[model samples]
Target: MAYKPPTRAGATVYVWSNYSLQERDRRWKAVRESGAKAGFDCIFVPLGDGIDARYLTQLRCSSVVLPTDGRPPIIIADRSSSNTWAPEPWQTSREWSEPMAEALLELGMERARIGVAGLKGGRVSHVTSIDGVVNHGAFAAVMRRLPNARFEEATDILGFARYIKSAEEIASMRKAVEIAEAGLAELAAAARSGVDAAALYARVMARMLELGAEYFPWALTLGMSDGSDAKRFTDPPLGRRLKANSLAQTEMIAVFGTQIAEEDQAVLLGPIPEAWKPVVARQREIFDEGVKLLTPGRSCAELLEFSKSVAEKGGMKAKVRLVGRGAGDDGPVIGAMTQPDALKELTVEKNTLWLWRPTVTGADGKTRFTWGGTVLVTEKDGELLSKRAHGAISVA
Candidate 1:
């Protein structure tokens, strides 16, 4: 599918901090519908964020959110404490925030209400940080710059944004999905009698790169591991080897343009595991049940109750918390509607996008087979984003 810009736009949003050129531009283009509504005239990409002001000037913009516009400034500083492997050094430099504030003020932004958002990725540690990224101090400094500014705390801003995808964002996600599909197809074809897990991952990742993915959003995980072991679903490269007849499960993301599309699939290398036969059947049953449960005007709590009943009937150790989630901004908005703190009530709105996964434990005491796919919740019905076959396990 060809990429189409969003019919809507954003408010005077500024990508004022340090981000790669591809990422910034992709984000800007994907949510054009929302940006247009917010009166998005120009996206002020700082010279430091790998964007050349001269090249940017040639593009369309209402006015550059730079310091020369000379008005009260509303500076926004973004920092995340998440599982990112690398520290974005450009963000930590003390002097970065001040200049951004000045530039916003100069560009006619009302300095009175600088807003900041802080995200802390899923962390079990008692006193802060995911994979070592933190920004409490950075956020505080931005607050000092604009005393009256308001702030919001989000565990995952991009994750939240992803749920509200514009047409452009949807197109980007679809493109990423295509690349992932192609790479995985290549991976399946290349599998041999005794391929190691590391070798398989390297091959798939290389294929993804060849298909235009700049980075792998998540590390590839392989083995006959169950869903319980799926906690570390994404892992960095390692020396894990694959068993001859083992089932290979991979959860990964393709970084294309500004969006990262997430994909997960499993393959039976030589012969299907006998233990997995019934498990796979149970997965299909649950998937159908979940899909049928998705109708407009249904409460999130109500659907969860129904899902729970279905899980119990199948003799699965089903937890509603692992159900469906929204997939938009950063990737998929993961959460079970059954949780007491459900992100949003059911009441599926037209055009709302969701990714739902239902899993069940096997007789062998592992989360062996599960199924999920991204779909659009329209007024009429549900439309799947990344289509996959139901009932049949993908055989290599």
Candidate 2:
């Protein structure tokens, strides 16, 4: 089916989840505020076991999820709340979707009829035991009951709307960045030449926690001098100690309440890598090109095209899809790098705040680098949120 924007532009959106009630509500509130800013009339959230109603009561929108009634236009069985409501009926995520499909059938929404909005996964194979296979099972179940029901994946709609950052969202991310950066800065000072990678990560985690972050932003990658081991980016810490002059790549994902925030930085403990100078320069150039392209009226595709030119000019061949994305409720979707096949086109809009980190491999095939910052889109240009000194390397 061709992608369609949501018809419930101003209708109430319900968010369901099985995580910490406080965290789930926080995410729901973030969306609620974003929805209101984008002209949504109401964003409803169902209260479940362990949910604190008094806390969610502060929001202006209709924040309550009512018990299911056999009625049309009433979306039942959100991805997260189905099993909570009917344990036995929802043996797995797939079963949970049936209730919504049943509800849609009762509501008169039928196959290809349209006017229904729901969430789905990136791929059916990737669906977990908890969320049943994306929206297909639920959509199919609903359609099977009522042949006229029309339903579209709500993920794209909500994700596209969330593409732009809000003040509250920005504050949440900034808090994460601040805490993470401070941890990195402190780690830099406390880092001894012989400290093990795991130990250093522990220090970072401790310092970040001290600074009030909800969790550690993961570990830093100790890049090999040969660059042959760049694959180590995803490898777990070997508990290897920091060599006096080894190159290290530091990227972090800090949690704020429930939101995930990320930042990346590189450092040379004792002696700067001979190849780092050019790599750092090229990374900075990429950052400039990316920031320049983030202006209003630019599509994310266009900005990525510009990044490709900058990368080619700098002689790097790595595929750097998007430097950044919307970092709010979800980590990846709301954040950077809208794929070409992405359901929604990332049209840069006014009041949109983005975090971009365009990366490139240095001329010396051995050196890899990345850099950028958070920016808010204004009527004229993008505003910087994470203040940094010149270039991608903030050498203290």
Candidate 3:
């Protein structure tokens, strides 16, 4: 059965993996309700984590449409053999630009305005570079195919839309937080003298999978430090054995049903150095102070200012590595200093999720301490998603 689209003025919206199908549906429904025809132009099938290939199959088969209205959304799948997933006989195959032009023409949108996923020299929405290239190529193809068609970059439109999570998305993210806590526990246990970075990573990852984590889109960064210097020399886990007095720091992300949670901590393998004790203590203070400011309606610029005060109180200079970002498929990154005005205007909405990490550089500039986690904005305050303690743990 062919899915029938809702009655509205038709517009083509481009999307990729980082944007979930649920998000796409929400956008389509909103557009339709506003008397606009909204259709999706998927740049390609995402093969790896976050997106399930079966969803692509359903989109190709027209078995499902926007989940909300059950309306068959006009979908233009990238049919280039290299761009698509495992091809099926029923799937419509076409060169990158050909199908886009065809879909618009079939919809009688040859001269109508269309939305592309990105603008030239703009922030990308997809997780992988492959999808980025596909998006850029699709844009070029559309311009070449229909010179009269109007093109608009809808990057921020889709980005801010994803900030407010639905109930279903919140549930999935809670599960992701649970898995991250479990993984952090395993990581703490595995951080010991004579343990190599590779072994630690393998053990924690295996435990996360064992505990029902679907996948991790990113790698766990594990590094070792001797406390003599502030710099943490990190590389791919290559069997470098940790010493008794070393500190192991790890930054990790665990995914549950495409929702992600982050865990970053330092574990003391042996007796804590006297000088390191105060640094760890101050890091905990900074984390607590920063998280306390994660209330609804608070802006990232406010958080950035708070971070500076926290660092000064902790006797260090605040080095804002990351302020916060959209946690799910729409990865809208908001840094502290780079885009301060944009950050100031963008207030945290209830049900929106963020990852905030505030770091402090020591007087020597070589040593640094950092802490943060996934935070969910609520009516009253920001909720820390991960149950793990905010401070570094003693593994020895």
Top candidate, metric lDDT? 3
**In angstroms, how far off is 98's CA in candidate 2?**
7.5
lDDT of each: 0.46, 0.47, 0.53
Per-residue alpha-carbon lDDT of candidate 2 for residues 120-181, written as tens digits (9 for 90 to 100): 33211111122422335434554465564333333333444445455565566667667767
Q: Once model 2 is optimally superposed onto the true structure by TM-score, how far is the C-alpha of residue 48 displaced, in angstroms?
A: 16
TM-score of 2: 0.64
Q: Candidate 2: which stretches are off by over 4 Å?
A: 1-148, 216-219, 226-236, 257-259, 314-324, 327-345, 390-396
State which candidate, 2 or 3, has the greater TM-score: 3
Residue-by-residue lDDT tens digits, candidate 3, 1-396: 222222332232322233355654564455333223343332222112112222333232121112223334345332321112322211233233554455455555456655443242123134222233224554466578678766654333334444567776677778777887787788777777777767777788888888777555335434444435223333346756666756666666777645677767666676655556566667666667666777887766676566555546545566544434333344335444455544546666788787777666655554556666788878888888878766667777
Clashing residue pairs for model 3 = 9-37, 230-367
Best-fitting candidate, measured by TM-score? 3
What TM-score, computed on C-alpha atoms, does each candidate reach?
Answer: 0.64, 0.64, 0.74
Candidate 2, residue 369: Cα displacement in angstroms equals 2.0
Could you tell which candidate, 1 or 2, scores higher by lDDT?
2
TM-score of 1: 0.64
